[model samples]
Target: MKKGMTWLAAMAVCVTLAAPAQAADPIKIGVQGAQSGDLASYGVPSLNAVKIVVDEANAKGGLLGRTIEVVAQDDQCKPEMATNAATKLISDKVDAVVGPICSGPTKASLPMFQEAALIAVSPTATTPGLTEDGKNPLFFRTVANDNAQASLTSDFMLNNLKVKKVAYLHDNGDYGKGFADKNREIMEKGGTETVLFEAVTPDAVDFSAVVRKLRRAKPDIIVFGGYQPVASKLLQQMRRDNLKTPLIGPDGVKDETFLKMTGKDSEGTYASYPKDTSTLPEYKKAREAHIKAFGSEPGFGYYNAYAAAQCLLAAMEKAGSTDTAKIKDVLRENQVDTPLGKLSFNAKGDAAGMGLSIYQVKDGKFVELDHSIVLE
Candidate 1:
């Protein structure tokens, strides 16, 4: 009888040891990004920023005493890839999802997220259609949309700089096309004439043809609705061909990589962006922490991604449960204090009371040129 009791006691100890492991299951969060495509610069850094936040959160005993696990997937800036990634994350039952950084991928994959009842917060997807659709209550974005940026950019070009005629160029993609359309609409509404509007394939290496067209039109300013890769090449080729009009662009062209790609040619280019880090104390502290951790300043997508993750975690904590419905409600109603300051979502899940800031590339660096111009 004593020998039997000893065996049972040993089994009890084994069960107790296994219980801790089972109780410590990591709360998984899905993170999707274009880790291997044209937009990798934006995706990779944003993923790294998410990691930084996850690490910091875990170090603080994690959420609800459970460690956070970020399940990262590469969407490669493709819609199909984004859909597959979203499906896989949904099947895996992640508590929340962070991105599909580019707008094309974000728009393509949003339906899957909605069907799966997952809370998705995009760090960089700024296309207006994502939130304006009125179909997906779960879709949220930390970045300002193209409509807001385009309005402010139009005002800056028309009212401030007093450019009466503007030429608009965009890469033929959802992001580029959407911003170009919005900018044209706003500029025309403000009584400014858009002399030339054109869309070029993002991979086009020869922009002399477009430059010739622009030169023929002879607008005072050229507004580019695209990211750095195309913008840099276009600007460089324009310079080589001696097209000397001032360039204006949206947030996609505001990164340091744009200057690096275009070199001296990037000088005098103007860009519209959300609030700069220099103006926020919380952002300054976050920037210092990020530099210390990653050995460089956080890029545009980095801080935004971190803020998105912080917002998700804050909502999770407020809901006190991993239930998606409760979490979504918490996200919509609660104000999250993140590295970017107090962020609150509207009924549409878009950031509320946010504005865009204008920057100018002077000496190959983006310098904040004006104060925040409120849109709504």
Candidate 2:
């Protein structure tokens, strides 16, 4: 019996000896956004910024002594695909998430992330209702809500442009149309006459019908609330039909894709983007890192994404655990220095103290205009 017991003990020892040492599990972060498709320009730069932030963090020995791992899923800016991406991230055991860039996908993915009790910070996704509705507690964003953006845009139109009549247009998607609606409300409140308020089909190859309407209306300015693909087509059609009304757009139209698509036609168009911070040392470092990694300048949402990742990491470090509730508390209470200046989240999940600036396409590049965010 003693010999048998000794043999059994030896077998246990052998099994234990054969077992590999378990390393500390990595703290995985999921980057969910459009890595391909039409909006790749927006999402890819966001992912690049996150990657640079993560790489730097890892180089310094990842958070809480556990290495951080990044997992990205392309949602193509589609709602259905966003849920799938969120599911994949959850299955991959990610502790937190960074995006689902557009407002629609962000809205669609929120319930799933909520079910998993995962927290996500969006760099874009500016629709007001996303956070204002207060349905999702885990939601946060680095960009101001569409309300702020619309207010700024309206203020620009009412004060700077001083136009008597305005034409408001949107692609009819939640994000675009929501922005358009807000702008419409604010402009009307400011006593500006709405010459034409219309929704354009997102898939329409020709926008001449609407351009014709603008021509007939002869509005002082055209405000287009939509993204690049539709914006490019609409602008081209408008210009082709000789409609020279100044068309102002949202940040969705600020990408290189828009400029490349429209070329000379893109010139003189204005877009409201989050204020440029390239002058800041931190922003410059991030830009250098991005260029090093991707060999080009960062595009739309790049600064916002960098800020989002920095704030997320800062919140995680301050929270001292992966507990989302704790992290959320940290996010609300703490401020992090980002390229966009020191940023913290308001109760509505909008980035506090962030400013928007108007940029005009000049010489094939977006040039910052003198006027900027002066919201009341």
Candidate 3:
């Protein structure tokens, strides 16, 4: 009897030790984005938002009762580097990925994620090609596509601003060029003449040649499709060259970095974004939590990243497993409540009911237009 009791006590201790070990096996999440370079203005805030969401989820006993760990990889906003980051994440066995914030990087890295059966939810990659051709079933984004923003802006320019002749400027990257092309087509179809279409190497400090071309074209407005760094520089150079053509940019220029880079020159410029929700009562908790974790209010791409994390966690919980296939199916069939709103994906993995609002720079800040447009 004494021997049997001692054996039972040993077994109890073993079970106690093993229970914690089982619970400690973390569900790995990969965060792929530009941690450095000009795009960091957007990517860093997004990563901060992701951390806040994941930390909050972990506090309530992480997804599926397992701890969650983030495997962060910096792609520097480059395509090949993004592919390498995706490869590393696959090797590390991350259960899901949160980024590749730019469209080009996302495109380059998407095939690898699809092949590995990993769920990739991007907060910002808005190119239509991501979902147009049935490219990857496992990929999703919290934001609307560029087509919606471009169309809305084109309509606003024609109807509201009454612009006749416009010029197009774009960075040569996939994201910028795609956005510019879509906007050009829409504006032309809407009865606005495209006076000039030009591409500039991204990160170029001088726009003398482009400004000269724009002067020749004599456009009433210039639409730029590119990220903050290039957009800011182009605007500064435009002012230097005394070109008074009003410039409108896409979502890529909607960061605070643009204002900081262009100073007073950024005033009166325009950009489009999903309607702001940071002040709404529904997102009050999320906003406070983000500030608590990051020691500041969230910036560019914050809400979208939080929404992406919510989508991933909610899908994982609903599926009752970490299997990517199951989670993907759950994401398709179910709606997840996020700080942005209740979110659902369409057949193409695009967010349904997402839309855009045109914002103009007012006294060095972005303010909404009198109206907003929804993307169906």
Candidate 4:
């Protein structure tokens, strides 16, 4: 009996020693975005969406019996800042990351993330090359690449808008420039003339000179490739210069910030964004929680961010471990029903079925023009 008691005490000591490993503090989730700067509206919403998701997840007793914590790092949508964000997250020992929103930033920092064996799910990075040839196996996204978006835009401009000559303007960054180039290529292939292709300095507040050049081009439509700040300023300057040509844009300018900036001038402006799933229960729940917390509708990429965070958390649960490799496998194989609907990733890390849809500024807000523009 004495020997048995001594052995039992030793066993109890072993159990106590092992408890801490099993009950390690909350799992850390890193969220990277343009938390502050000219693109604050674009980035803050992604953080807010993740916060809402994190809160809901914690409320439900967390995932895999471990509470989740968000470690947000702001990249400010700059390439240099993005590398810094990745370094900090690596130091933080986060299990996964949600974004580095801009394509330039995402491209600059992805190698660091890959080296760290950290899994990432971008809510808005849409460059085509990011996922090609399975280069970044650790990287995944809830957004479609710009290649598909470009195809859709070409079809829309050719078939729906029926424009012949178009002007192309870009911010010269990876996302903006790549999207603009793709659009020009597609439109040219369809026999539409690209009258002018120009890159504007993204930070320049005065675009009157560029607007002047655009006016001389006399394009039927202007395709602006960049975020709302530049787009808004360009549109404002174009209108002020009496160039009433309709300016169409991509997801970067689809936010309410663009609408607020352009005001009356925003009318008839078109942009392509992820298809709306506002009617779905998953989407409704997220929106309700966002409004309850933030007192307004969620901003651009909010739903996509929600979907991203949910995908990460769900993959962790499905894999039954925080091991990124296993979670990555689950992410590929399992379908997660997020605010974006049933979501799964391909080998290239792009989300399946999350195609771009057209939205137009109607009555001071962006309203869905068409969601069924499928491109081969």
Which residue ranges in model 4 land beyond 4 Å of their true spot?
1-18, 371-376
lDDT of 1 at 143: 84
TM-score of each: 0.94, 0.93, 0.94, 0.94
Error of 3 at 47 (Å): 0.8
**Cα error of candidate 4 at position 193, Å:** 1.0
Q: Per model, how many backbone clashes are there?
A: 0, 0, 0, 0
lDDT of 2 by residue, 44-97 (tens): 999988899999999999998788888999999988788889899999989899
Model 3, 1-376: lDDT tens digits are 9999999999999999999997678999899998888789888877887788889888998877788888899998889799889999999999999997889999999999999989999999988899887878889998878887788788888888988899999887778888789888988888889889989988676789999999999998989988999998899999988887888888879888888889988889988888876666546877888778878877788888888888898899999998988998998888876777777888889886655789999999999887577655
Tens digit of per-residue lDDT, candidate 4, span 239-332: 8777899988889889988888889988889888877778889999999999999999999899999999999998999899999989989999
Q: What TM-score does candidate 2 reach?
A: 0.93
Where model 1 places Cα greater than 4 Å from the true spot, the runs are 1-20
lDDT of each: 0.84, 0.87, 0.86, 0.88
Writing each residue's lDDT as its tens digit, candidate 1 over 1-376 gives: 9999999999999999999989778898899988878778888878887888888889999998799999988998788788888888888878889998889889888888888888889988889888885887889988888888888888788778988888989987888888889989988887888799999878888888898899899998998888888998999999988777889888889887787789989889998887765567767767777889889877768877888898899889999877899999898888866665678888887887555789998877888876567534
Q: For model 1, name the residue pairs that clash.
A: none
RMSD (Å) per prediction: 1.9, 2.4, 2.3, 2.8
